[model samples]
Structures are given as structure tokens and as C-alpha cells.
Target: MSEQAKENPILEVESVHVAYGRVQAVRDVSFSVPEGGLIALVGANGAGKSSVLAAVSGLVRPGSGRIRLEGKDITRWPAHKRVGAGLVLVPEGRQILGTLTVAENLRLGAHRRRRQAAPESEMYELFPVLAERRALPASALSGGEQQMLAIARAMIARPRVVLLDEPSMGLAPKMVDEVFAVIERIRASGVTVVLVEQNARRALRAADTGHVLETGAIAHSGPAAHLLKDPRVVKAYLGVE
Candidate 1:
């Protein structure tokens, strides 16, 4: 990684609060993802983990505080504009186009300016299975492949930071491993990842840092290694016996 990249964070959420109607979803959440690290957000459902991701991706507006990309305030930016600013979200449910061919879906991911031959080659490198199944309709692929394609499509946009929500949800054990491997590779390639996972133990293991959310607020935040060894974290989230 470049020295400059290591010196600056790609995304920063500072004291953000978000609400839906009368219910507050995120309360004063603050965290930073460095340019090339996997940062995990772990919590039970309705703990505001997804809320934070939505707020970062512009799907949900923060009622207070600021979001910065490369140190620029982007709290008020819309979703499409956030993508243009090199922030992308691979939303939950692997929202692939079921009727579209794998190649077609990937093509849709690129902006008009970035629809070059090089992106296809890059994606093929990141996901060889995608190259093999490029002609198949997205619906025909296995669950893991669909998730891989969803991630590869996001990467095709050349985003600096990618927000992944519940990436391991509803997948088989082997498939979960495959998905986490892909996440590690993305971070190795210098893309900052803000990952939310219901599988708290696995999430903390895969991330460089982990944050625990409870009732719309961050209850704890620290290095993943340290958090893994923490008794409270293990007892509460990891189900320690």
C-alpha cells in the first residue's frame, strides 16, 4: 500500500445518529475504517448495525453528526452521489439482478466512464468463477456464487470503501468461509471494508477491528484480537461456556 493511503482513513463516521420514523436506529455512533483494513460491526438484530451501514451508504440520513470520505463531509450526499464519490454498498440479501446474466450484471455496476475492458479482466482475476459463469443468468448460480458476484460487481465500481451488510447471513458454513476469504482479499487490495455480521465470533475473527452495537449505540470498540480475548465480548456475543 502507498504511504499516503496508510496515513489517511478512507471513511469516517463521527458521532452519527439515525432514526426511522419515531424509532432511533443509531445513537452517536463513531468509527473509522483505515484505507486498507477490514473493520467489523457486530451486534444482534435491531442493534443499529445495519442502520450505520445504511447511513454511510446514504440510504438512511443521519439525524445528526457527520460522515467523511477522505476527510470531506458527505453527511448530506445522496446514495448515487456517494457511489460517485468512491463509496459503495453491497447491501444485504446479495441484491443481484436475477434475470440478468453474470456479465450483464457486472456491466451495470460500472459507471459510463469506467466501462472498460480492464474491469472485466480485473473482476476475472478477483473471481475466476465469475468468468466461468459469465453467460449464466444470475438466478442460476449457487448462493455463494451469487454473493461473490454481488461483491465483484461492487468492486468493479473501483470503490475506495465498501460497506458490506450481513454478508454471512443465511449461508452454509463452507460458503461463509468463502465469503470471508473474499473479504480478506478485498482488504489486501487496499479497499477499506466496513462489514456488519450477525455472526459476531466469526466477524471479530475476520476483522482488524470490531465494534459492538446495542440498542442503537456502540457499546464497545477495539482491536479484533483483543476483543476476541475479552471475557465480556465472548460471553455476550461469542457464547462462551
Candidate 2:
């Protein structure tokens, strides 16, 4: 939505590296996320897409380089601190509290730290299924329903940017469609999004920009439309004929 000239990035990852003991997971990777834009990191498992997202969310500390939010370095900040600073991560799996009712889980997500969270009424409007089962225990929901609850939980916190890792993992085909629809709505709401998904085609289709990762490094980077149409990308990642 930003007219090219004045577009400024809200988050920047500069030469970031992440390691797990002897294994290097991310190798000097860097990218910028513009405010209200959606970027996707797509690759096979072990390609380090999740690791990069973890580093950004402060769920895992990068071995080196800088992570900035609104141009302020936050590489050393803790996870909760980053959340308080308007960053939230809906991690790899939908991590809803199984015992709590859907409404209770939503209320908990809007902790005192939220600068401005969506009202429960608005969340119900955004996720009608959640509203339909508002009083049901989280465990009663299907995998797709749980994913919706997970996303709603994050959105209720009103983060400036959200990091979503593998949101479509383990979802049914119809559910995957619904999840993507919600993602588009999230982007339209002006919240910057960083998505890591294994379904390359769908992810690229939903993104403003797409980055293909291989062996912990970016193998391709371009506008989403370009990446989707790239012959090599189509053959190697998109799984289309």
C-alpha cells in the first residue's frame, strides 16, 4: 500500500547468523520488512526458515549481526520484551491452551502489555468460527480451528508486526484455503507479516515478496509475482508443471 518513494521498512535484519552447537542454521541472512507488507520464507524442512523467524522473534538468539525494529537495535532483547515492543510470534505449531475456552484464551492473549488490542467483539467478527465456539474448550477444535485461534490470539494483542511459522502445516486442503484467506485479511489490516511456510506456491501467492531458502541461505529473492513465475522456482519449489 506504500507508494514506492516514501516506503520505509519497519523491521530490518542485518547480516544475522544462527547456530546450534556445531551446526550453522542461518548464514549472514538479511532482509527488511516494510510496514503493512507480507513477506514469505519458503523452503523444504531444515532450510532454516523457522530458525530465521525464531531469531527475529527473540525465541532463539542469533550468534551475530543485528536485528532492528523501527530502526532501533533489539538483538539482545528478550522474547517478552520484543512482544511488548509490538512484535509477536505465532510459532510453528498452533500452541493453543487445550484446557481453556476459546474466549478465555483470547482474553489471556491481550495481556496488560498490549499497546492496543482488538476487542473481543471485533475478533469474533474477524473469526466467526471462533465466535461460534467461543465457550468450547480449545481441545475440542479441529487442527484448522486451533490454527485460527492461534492467529486470533496474536492479533488480539495488536502487534505492529507478526511472525507466523508454518501456519498451514498439518492442515486439510479446505482449511489451508481458510488460513490463507485469514492471512490476506491480516495483511490488509496493515500489520506487517513474516510468514514461513512449507507450501511454497500458496505462500508465494500470498506474499508481497518471496525468499527461497536452501541450506540456511537465500537461494532466490524477488517480488512474489516474479518468484511465482520464475521457471527455476516453479520447478524446484512451487511444485507446478
Candidate 3:
């Protein structure tokens, strides 16, 4: 990452608030993600992590404040436009089209910019299992494989930043490890990552920074390593598991 981009965050959410009808989902939440760095938003359900991502991804409009990507205001851009501008979100569920062939599903991901997207062969290289089952229906894959497919689909969009919501949510322990390893590879390849995960310890462990949200506000924010050992964080979220 360039020093300038890191100094001035590639993606910035400034005092953003989100509401659904009369109930507020996010309240004056703000954070900046450095280019190519990974940040995790960790909190219990209903704490508003997903709402924050939704606002940024343009799935839902923020009621107030602003969102910027690479220093350009994109608060009102539509979701497809955001995707076209290199902001991609892999939603909570592995939302791959079950009936489509694996290759077909991957092809759909590059709909925005085919030239910039990695070749199908390259995606196959990243997820060998996907290649092995390319001709098969997506439903034929295991949960872990489906999750890999979901990520591969997003990557094919040539994203500059990826917003991951609960990537490890439903998998077995071993599968969860595999998914996180993939996440590491993605960040290593220079894509900024905003991860909202339920597994606080694992998320914090993998992130450059960690934000602990409570009741729609950030209760704690710091370097991931510091958050890992924080007494209050450990007691409230990490637990003794």
C-alpha cells in the first residue's frame, strides 16, 4: 500500500448512522480502513455490524453522515455502481446460485468488468476444489466449498476492497479455518478487507484493527493485538472458549 493511501484511509465512514423505520441500526459509527489492510467489526447479534456494512455497500442508505472510497464521496451511489467501483460485499449467507454450474456462477461475478477480472483458470488455481467441480451444480459442493465459491465469485469482480459478513458463520471448525486462510490470502493479494464476524477472538486475531460494537456504537477500537488482550473485551466477547 502507498504511504499516502494508508495515511488517508482508502475507505472512510464518518459518523454514519443507519435506521430502519423508527428504529436506529447504527449510531454515529465511524472508522477508516487503510488500503490493503484488514479490519474486523466484532459484536453480538443486533449490535449493528451488518447495518454498518449495508450502509457502506449501498444496500441501505445511511440516515446521516458520509461514506467515501479513495477520497471520493459515494454515500448515495447504488449498490451496483459501488460494485463497479471496486467495492464488493460477500454477504452473510453463502449466496451462490445453487442450481448454476460452478463455472457459470463464477462467470456472473465478472459481469461488471471482464477485462480486469482474473481469468477463470486463475480462480481455479486459488480454489482447486472449485475447478474440480466446475462442471457440476453448485449445490453439489460441501458447505466449505460453497463458501469458497462465494468468495471466488466476489474476487472475480476485481475488487479493491471486500466487505465480508460472517464468512465463518455456518461451517465446521476445520472449514472455518480454511475460510479464514482464504481471507488471509485475499488480503495478502492487496485487497482491503472489512470483516464482520461472530467469532470475536478469531476475527481480532486475523485483523489489523478491531472495533467492538455494542448496541449500535463502537465500545472499543484499537490495534487487533491490543483488543485481543483487553480485559473487558476478553470478558465480554472472547469468553473462556
- Models ranked on lDDT: 3, 2, 1
Ranking by TM-score: 3, 2, 1
- Superposing every Cα of model 1 onto the true structure, what RMSD results? 1.9
- How far residue 223's Cα lies from its native spot in candidate 1, in Å, is 0.6
Please, what is the TM-score per model? 0.94, 0.96, 0.98
Alpha-carbon local distance difference test for all models: 0.89, 0.92, 0.94
Counted clashes in each candidate structure: 0, 0, 0
Q: In terms of TM-score, how similar is model 2 to the real structure?
A: 0.96
Task: Give the winner by lDDT.
Answer: 3
lDDT of 2 at 13: 91
Tens digits of per-residue lDDT for model 2 on 1-241? 7565126789899999999999999998889989998999998899999999999999899999999998889999999999889999999788899999999999988982555877889889999999999999999999999999999999999999999999999999999999999999999998999999999999988998998999999899999999999998998887744
What is the Cα-based lDDT of residue 146 in candidate 3? 91
lDDT of 3 at 233: 98
Cα lDDT for residue 64, candidate 1? 98
**Over the full model, what C-alpha lDDT does candidate 3 score relative to the true structure?**
0.94
Q: Give the TM-score of candidate 1.
A: 0.94
Local error of candidate 2 at residue 98 (angstroms): 0.1
